[model samples]
Structure formats: C-alpha cells, structure tokens
Target: MWPRGDDDIIRSNSLHESWSTGALNIDMLFPTDYFLFQVAVCSALLSAVSPLRPAYSTALENALRNELFVDRNYSLLQRPSQQVDVRVSLTLLTVNELNVKDQFLSESGYLSFSWQDSRLSWSNTSATSQDYSNIDSLFSTELYVWTPALIIENSIQDMSVISDTKIPMRITQDGWVFWSPSGVYKVSCESDITYYPMDTQTCYLKISTWGYSKSEIGLSLEIGTPVDDSFYRENGEWDLLSVAGHPPIVNARKGTWYSSLGFSVTLRRKPIFHVINTLFPVILMGFLIPMVYKLPTDSGEKMGYCLTVLLAYAVYLTLISDDIPSTSKTVCLLSVYLGLTLTFSTVSVNIVIYILYAHFEGDKEVPAWIDNGVRKFGRFTRREKRDQNKVKPSTKEEHCDDKKLTAILENEENNNEEHKPITYREYSDILNTFFFVLYMAAMIILTIIFLLPLLINYLTNG
Candidate 1:
C-alpha cells in the first residue's frame, strides 16, 4: 500500500471570489482535519506506556499460575502441618536516645528474620525467577506474598500503634523465608536510683506476634552469642555492659498459649559528669560549715554568710529535684547526704545565736558556770588559769607586765589601779577557737562513716 500524502487526505476545495475585484481563486488547505490528527498521536502514546509485561509471557505465567499463584485467599497458617513454627532474631544498629527522666530508651535496629509458608511453593526447574536476582530481571510481576504482622509488646506507654511493616513479602519454592525490618523504638525501663548518678540499669526489649497466640504461630529466639563490644557504638551517657536474651517464655491466657522473647540491655551510667556538676559543689559548700562558727559575731557577717550558703544549698536541691522524679520509688544517696548537711547547717546557726547573746550580756557578774565552762572547753592551761585568778599590785614588779592592755585607771585615795571588766571580745575569741576544732572533728567522723562507703562501691563497680 502507498503512504497517503496530505493532498490525498480530505481538505476543503472551495472556490473563493473577492467581493471588490470579482476575481476567482481556489484554496485547498482551508478547514483541515486537525482533530483527526490529534486522536492518532494520542493513540500512539498510550500504546508505548502500557508495554506487555511478563504476565503476558503465557508459557511462564501459565506455569507459575498453575503451580504457585493459585492460592490468594486461605487461612493465615497455610501449611499441611499442624503448627507454623516461626523463629525470630535481631541485628542491632544503634541505641541512640535514652531519656532517664522519662524512663524510656529509644532503640534503632532491624530484625534478622525468616519464616515458612508452604502454600506459596512450586518447582523452580523451568522458570525465569529461579534465582532471587532473576526475579528482578524478569518483567514487573511479583506474586503477591503475605507476611506475618509482628509487634513490640513492651514499648512506651504513649505509643498507640506498634512498629512493623505491611508490604507483600517473598516466598521461595523450598519454603525458605527472609525479611529484615529496622525501626527506632522507645522501650519503657524502670531505673534503680539507689546509688544514682553512679547507678547501673537493665532495660528490656520484648518481641511478640500482634494477633496470633503460640498455638497458631510458635515463636522462638536463637540466642547464639552475647552482644559483642562493637555491636553498639559507645555512648557518652552510658557504658554498655552486656546484652542477653532469655529463652522463649510461654504465656497462657483463656486456654491458649502466647510466645515472646525478652532481651536485657545492661548499662552503667557514666557518672564523672554527675560527680562534677551535681556532687562536688554540694560537698564544697558543706565544708564551709566550719567557717560559720569561726566568724566573729562583731563583724555581723557570720549569720549572713550562713544564710547565703543555706540559700545556695536550697537552689542545688531544687535543681536536683527537677531532674529526679519526686514520686520515685528509690531516692538518690547524694540527696540523702545533702539533707543531712542541711540539718547540720541549721544546728550551726542555732549555736551562733546562743554564743552572740552570751557574749553581749552587759555588766552582769561572770557566772561561776561561765568560768568553769570556759576553762574546761576553751583549752586554758593550769598556769594560765592561776595567772588569770591572781590579783596584781599597783607596783610594776608585782603585776604581770602585759603592755597590750587598752586601758588603765587609778583609785582616788590609795592611788591603786582598778581591775578592768571582762570584755565581750575576749569571750567571743575563746568560743570561736573552741568550735572550729569541734566542727573539724565532726566532719572527719561523718566522712569516714557515711560518704566513704558509697565512694568505694562506685570505684569497685563503676
């Protein structure tokens, strides 16, 4: 057949006459059929788009259709055997986000997995999809393969849906299965804060089937080797101690068994940062307790200094309390120690008040108790006591010649010098010296008794 030219195609052949000059002419291209040409081009484009796939390969498609693709609707456990035994394993990528304050740990990892479905199997002798990669080289036709819907049972409370996938999976003729799924999950963990800031915790990752119980789909864990050091990256916040998964546990509810696997993730907190930021400052402020007694009441800063230190302690307590839950089952040991220090600080303030009052008692005769108490606790030697008690004559040779005396007065008739009154300054000096020694002794005893034990435990175990 000859190709039809545009002239052979239909076009308007009309004679046109100019109205003004009355000249006759013939036009051929007028009223051309562009609508017909447009329909022809569209038909060509549609034919290119929907190319014939392997489904149209009647020999292969018929082979697979007879042997493999017949069963689209059947029971979930499509097996000749009574039970579908499915074993699951895991390959960890990382554990990135751990929120101690929220009591949940976020894990990013995938499942190393396989399963069996006998219904979707056939002979692979005469097929293009014999090899796994060959299935890709063939036309875009993967037999719709259904996979199990698994889930994490012990995940965070806020999660409404469990982490999983729903895409159609693969099925081999030999009934071997393979699928790997990765996700980031926040598993709930209850931390023990008995030694907290220096504490170790064990969090669990649990896996189980979402709908089916063990009677339908039996679950098993292949706990081959414990987690290696290189399995997870080193975290600045925690040190991974060991990862262990226990044997499958069977749970029976309403006369049916449910199977699941439990993995324990053991970790110890890196506490050097906690020690420096939260603990050292508290301890340093506590040591200043001794200086409160040593400050002379005359300077009027002794009370003010004590209150300021107390206020600082209050701020530290507030900061720590915000980090640690008030409703926690186990309280931190550092918090306990801080509470004890605050108690001691309050006692010091009381002691300061009493001493200041006694020192300023004006012109009252020195009580006998005061003299005995000063001598007993103030470290005055026997010679010093005797010299203090003796009367000195007006004559220079009879007196203990201490020229540091600020004042001297003479009697009118006998020209004898009067003895000076005992001053508040003198009593304050004696009290300050005595209490400084007392506070130091108490601090040493408390350190040995209360604080050392905790420090030793951390050194041995941390």
Candidate 2:
C-alpha cells in the first residue's frame, strides 16, 4: 500500500480519519522539495526590481556642472564697457565690537544679494517645463561665477563670510539669482567718546564695487525694511536705536570717483553697570571726607582718614582711566568731579594739621583777632560736641577740684600772674569749634558745586 512502513500506517489512518471526519491533514504528506520551490518563486517575484532613485544633491551638482557658466567677465577686467547693477541688503546677526580707540567696527551678518546672469537665463524654462527644476536637489548646485573681477570697495578686512551655504544657490527661469551669504565684516568708523558711558554714538558701513567706475558698475541698496529688526541681536554695553542705509558717498581717490552705499547705526551706551561699579563708591567715599574733621584732634585719625579717602579716589581714577579711551581732547565729567574732591581732600588734611598744632599750644593765649574770628563762626562749645558725639563730659566735682588747685597755685606764684593768660586746653576749644564749622561749610559747598550742574542737566534733558 505504501513505500515505507510508517507511511503505509499513516496513510491508512488519514484515510480512515478522512472518512470519519471528512477533513484531511495534507501538510503531513507534503514533500520538502515542493515547499522549497514555492518559496523560491515568491522570492524571485518580490525582488524583481529596485525602488530607489538617484540622490537629489548629486542631481543638482550635475545640473550645475552641465549648464551654469561663471567665467565671463574676465576679458573686461582692465577696461570694462558694461557692468551689472547689483542690488544688495544685509541682515545683522551679531555686533562683535565697536572700537572707540581703534576706530573700527566688527560685525557678523547675512548679506542678501540678487543679480541677473545673462548666460544662465532661460525662457519658457519654468518649474513646470523643467523636470530637474521640479526636483529640489537639482537647484542645489555650485554656480560658476563668470565675473571674478567684481569686488567690494570700502571693505577694510575679511568681507567674505566664514561659513558658506551648502545648498546650491537657486536661479529662477528669468535669470534672477537670489544669493545670501553669511559674512564677517570689519569696517573703519569714526566715533566721539566725549560723554562716553552716557553718550550716543553713530557708526557707518559703506559698500561699493572695487575697480569699477560709476558708469561700469552701478550699486543700489534695497529700500523697504532696510534693517532687518528680527535678525538683529543685542549688544552687552550698547543699545541699537536705529539703522538706516542709503547711497551718500562720492569719494575721489587717484583721479577716480567712487560711489558707495552707507548704513548708519545709532547706538546708546548702557551706563548702569559702570555707574554702580566705578562711580557710586567713589562718590560715597568723597562724601565721607567730612567725618575726618568730626574726630577730635587728639584722636590722631583725622589725617589718616583724609589720606585714606584721597588714596581711594586715586585708585578709582586709575581703574576708570584704564578702561576708557586714552584721549585728552575730551575729559569725562566724573574725572572733573574726582579732581575737585581730591583738592578738597588735600585741603582737609592741612586743616587737620593746623587743628593739631593749635590744640597743643603751651600756656599761650590765643590772640584777640583769632578769638573774634572764632566767635563769628558761632560757639562750637565742648558741651554740645560732648553731648552730640555721645562722649561723656567730666563730672562737676572734677572742675571744682581743678579750680581749687589753680587758686592755690596762683597764690603760690603771684609774681608770674601777669605773664600767664590762658591754658592750652581752653585755647584748643576755641580753635576747634571755629575750624570745625569751616570744614562743614566746605563740605556743603563742594557737594553743591559738584551736584547742581548734574541735576540741572538731568531735569533740562528730561
């Protein structure tokens, strides 16, 4: 019935099961070769052709290599009869530095430019007509520049952008090439730092074609929305108020006239940081000079405090000098204030020396004129100072005992009574009160002289 014994038993069982259940288990009898044949046929049909296409970047490069020409303006490098009027605009990304001393500006931005190439133009070659134009990769091609002689004038250094665009510059069917390159430019600019931290400064960026005259190369800046507000970034110390561009330059050099497009940037300095760090502390120290005179001459700290304040002002002056531009033509207002206060400080030191000298007089009565002058300043009595400074006055018993001792001394030395006039302690009180009044007056005058003009200026400006 069957070739093998197991097959013969299985075939009989299957036939019985089929008659009993009307169902067949045919997989148990299928041959391995037949299964393999079916798999092979399916695999061949599925893998008949590849679904991939050529890469876009490669196709764009091929299109550029095949069509666009970039070397056509070389013959007229020396004597050019015709020139392309290129339209240009700039989008600021960063303002690196506006050097006041060096007279230059460093900037980074994207330069948007559009120009027509006669050789690259196509008519009826719109996006629908060209198959490659429909594909985005075909437009990403390295265009050949026919005119390498064309260059930017008034560019001090490094006009070319650091990072070039990888996406090939697209050219419309009408021969318009819209190209934007990211560039870093350093242009020479004139600045006036007269007011410095509070000053508003204006710098200019000029662009023009080099080696080509007005008739050969015509340059015009874009008009609408000239400075891209969204693209501009913030500066740390300066606020950009406005940026305006126009063609305002007609420079003559070596018997040739050159025209240029000018971009003026108006900026104001943010002075809060400098005021807090360098100016406020110095002003506080200047106001503290009066405290030196308030100390009694015996404390011996009046000169020390005066000198310390003077030295502090000196240090601040040095600090500010190192940062600002080194020019004597325009001196800062803060410097003048420091100089005046420094003079007052020097005078204060001398006044302290005089007070110490007068306070130590040995049994010499102060002259009538000095006493009269002291009275005119109003009485700066020892009682008032002792009470105000919180210094305790000697008890009443101490003065009574001193008077008794002096009476006994006078009785013993009656022969020298006519020569002796007043004690040193009494003389000191008179002089101290007079000079103290004078020192306070000086402080008030100095403060008013320094601050009045500044206040007036602020109110007037506002």
Candidate 3:
C-alpha cells in the first residue's frame, strides 16, 4: 500500500532502538499504524532473503496438459480415417548442392502438414471454463499423435517415414492439427546437361503417403503458392528461377490407388564461374587453332603450335568430364564443339607436315591443282588491285615487246640470269592463307552454334 525505501528502514530501526531502551510505548501507536508496521517488517525480511520470483500464466500449461492427457492412448500407427486429406506445403531454405555427376540434389527446407483429427477435437466452452480462452491451440510432440507419414518418393537417402520427436505439432480446439518439421533432404534428379554450363535444370521434390493408399490419405495444396522461398539462401553456382507445386498423381495397383505430389524447381546455371574457369579458356584455345597457319612454314613452330593447342583442348575435355555424368543418352553441345575444334587442330597439323614435305623435298614442277589454283587466285587479286588503283591496261606495242622478251629469256638456257619457275614454297604460302580463312571461319561458326544459346539465355534470364 505504501512505497518502501530507505525512510521506511530508518523508521523501523528507530522503533527497534526505542523498544530496546524502553523509551517507546506501544499505546501511543494507532491500530492502522501497528498493522502497517507489521507489514513493513515482513517486507524487509522477504527482501533480505531473495528477490521476488515471476509467476507464469497457468492457462497455456493447463490446456497443453489436458490435450496431451486425453491423447495419451492415441495410436500413431493408425490412420485418422479412411478419407483424411492432408494439405502439404514446402518452405525452401537452402540449395546446398546439386551433384550433376551423382544425379542427386541436396537441399534443406521445412515440410508443413495440416489435417483434421476427429478424436483430438474439443469444445471452446470447456477451454473458456478452464481459463484457457485466450489459448486457442495446444502443442504436443509429433510422436504423441497420429501423423500422415509423408516420405520423399525420390529420396536417395534412407526411405523411412519422417519422424522427429523434438518437433512438436499444433492442435486447435476444432481438431485441426498442424505439424512442420525441418530437415536436409537429398533426392534423385535426372540431370540433363545437353546445354551444359548454360543449362537450365528442372528438379522435382516428390512426396507421397508411405503406407496409406489414396483412399486413406490424400495430399493437396490448398494455398495458391505451395512452395515458398521467402527464406531461401542464394546458391553460388545455380540461380533459382521458379518453384511450382503439382497435384498428386493417382496410380492404381492391385485395385489400390496411391497418390504422389511433386514440386518442380527450375534452376539455371550461373555461367560466370563456369565461363571463366572452363568455357572462356576453351574458346580462347579454339581461337589459337587458326593461328597455327599464320606462322611461316619455314619458322618450324607451325607444327608445334598446332600440337600445343590440341593438347590444351585434350586437357579441357578431361576437366569437363569430371563435372558431367558419363551417359550417352544425350551429349553436351559444348563437348561436341571442343571435339570438332580438336579435330580441326589435328587436321591442321597433318596438312602442315605435308606442306613442309612439299616445300623441302618436292620436284621442281608444282602440282597441277596448286598451279592452277595459284594462277587463278593471283589473277583475281591483281585484277582487283588494278581496278582499285584505276591503272591503264598495257598497249599493243607493250604486249609485243613483252612477248619478244619472254621468247629471248626462254631461248637463252645458258644465260647467267636464271629464270625460276613457280615452286611448292609458293604453294605453301597460298595454302597458309587459305587455311587461315577456313579455320577462323570454322571457329566463329562453332562458337555461334554452341555458346550463343548460353549467351542468349544468360541475358534473357538475368
């Protein structure tokens, strides 16, 4: 009734001293004052002993106790009914890893299941009479009640019914039970790496009633959005595009119908890391394949350059092999592009060796094909140059003088000025130019065919 402070303690101490010295009279104090004094003494004693402890509300406790006691004999082994519908939803938290080679995906999330149990129902009037009107729900461990055993149908882990005693179930007054348990799930996913680094994968998380048939336990998503990603952690290698839930599939076996619900998760590969580590280097090496022709045949580095690029491609192919599963159902276009580039490099090396032989150990007369090709190429080039330069053609007198000069040079076999015929060395030069244009064009075409889709997807999706 009154604020107790240092003043109260001083007053009490003074009274005690007076009483001890016989200087105070109890008759002088009023009945109200005497009662107040007694109250102050008790307060002081209690404060000296320990601080006041907080009292908890018993409504929630009583509700939980009553619910658990009533369901103490509830058999978790039995189904609630022959037609219990369980609404299941998923909350995706993390995309830990998706092993392409193992064909399995690892993820951590929560599975929420809600259904009605007729035996667990109670009246609101009873709860209100028990002083638990504010407490609308009671919680009990999952092991204490019957639960629809929903198992991951495509799980690669132990195919057991999900049970976590530590996780509790929420039960309302109207027998509606809601249970949500979180765990790491590893499920089988058939990976299609046809586009590889720039590929988009659609993985599914399939759920089914383990022991109960469709007639006993049916699954559905009452909510519009069944798969939630509000708490999803971003994965470094893959970008989650969309998550969609599908209705349970009804299949009949031996006159028994079963149901399975699937959640489709579409994930696109993040091309930046793979591009820098694998694709960029492979493309860079591909460009080097055509550069082999630019080197002069006499430089003796042409063959070496081709072989070096070819070896680099071989190493890249081996590296890619580790990332993708070995299956012949479908081949990756990236691998095919690399194989084609490698083949071009090998053919270039062979052609170079042949050119070298022709240049060093061939006869004086050039091959007819080479000669004709060279002459035609020269004529086309000279004609273009002449047109571009706007130069006048040679006159009749000049033509006659050129003919007489050519005859004199042909007749003089012992002349000191020796006239050299077109040789294989010239042919090698022409072939080098031809090969340069050919392989560079091939590289460009291969890049467009293989990597262009990746670029388009990355840009469009990102």
Best by TM-score: 3
Candidates in order have lDDT scores of 0.62, 0.61, 0.77
**Cα RMSD (Å) per model?**
15.8, 14.9, 11.6
Roughly what TM-score does model 2 have, to 2 decimal places?
A: 0.63
TM-score of each prediction = 0.67, 0.63, 0.75
Write candidate 2's Cα lDDT for 8-110 as tens digits.
6776677567647867454544354347557976888776743233344665545543654333332223332266666667788778888776767888786
Per-residue alpha-carbon lDDT of model 3 for 1-462, expressed as tens digits? 556679777776777788889887665444667887789889999988754532336755664456545534566776777789999898999888888888888999989899998666654444432333345677888767888877888999968887788998998877899999999999998998888888888889998887788888999985776889999999998999988899889867688888788888888888778888888889988999888877876788877888888898888888898988988887888889888988998898898888787667544668666565566564332211111222233575356676775665434421321223356665666677777888999999989888777778667766
lDDT of 1 by residue, 187-271 (tens): 9888777676777778888877656777776777754642333556777788777777667787776887787777787778888
Candidate 3 residue pairs in clash (backbone atoms < 3 Å): none
List the candidate 1 regions with Cα displacement exceeding 4 Å.
1-66, 71-81, 120-146, 157-173, 223-231, 252-256, 362-387, 390-431, 447-454, 460-462
Which 10 residues in a row give candidate 3 its minimum summed lDDT?
Answer: 382-391
lDDT of 3: 0.77
Candidate 2 scores a C-alpha RMSD against the true structure in Å of: 14.9
Where does candidate 2 clash, by residue pair? 70-144, 70-145, 70-146, 71-146, 72-146, 161-183
Of 1 and 3, the candidate ahead on TM-score is 3
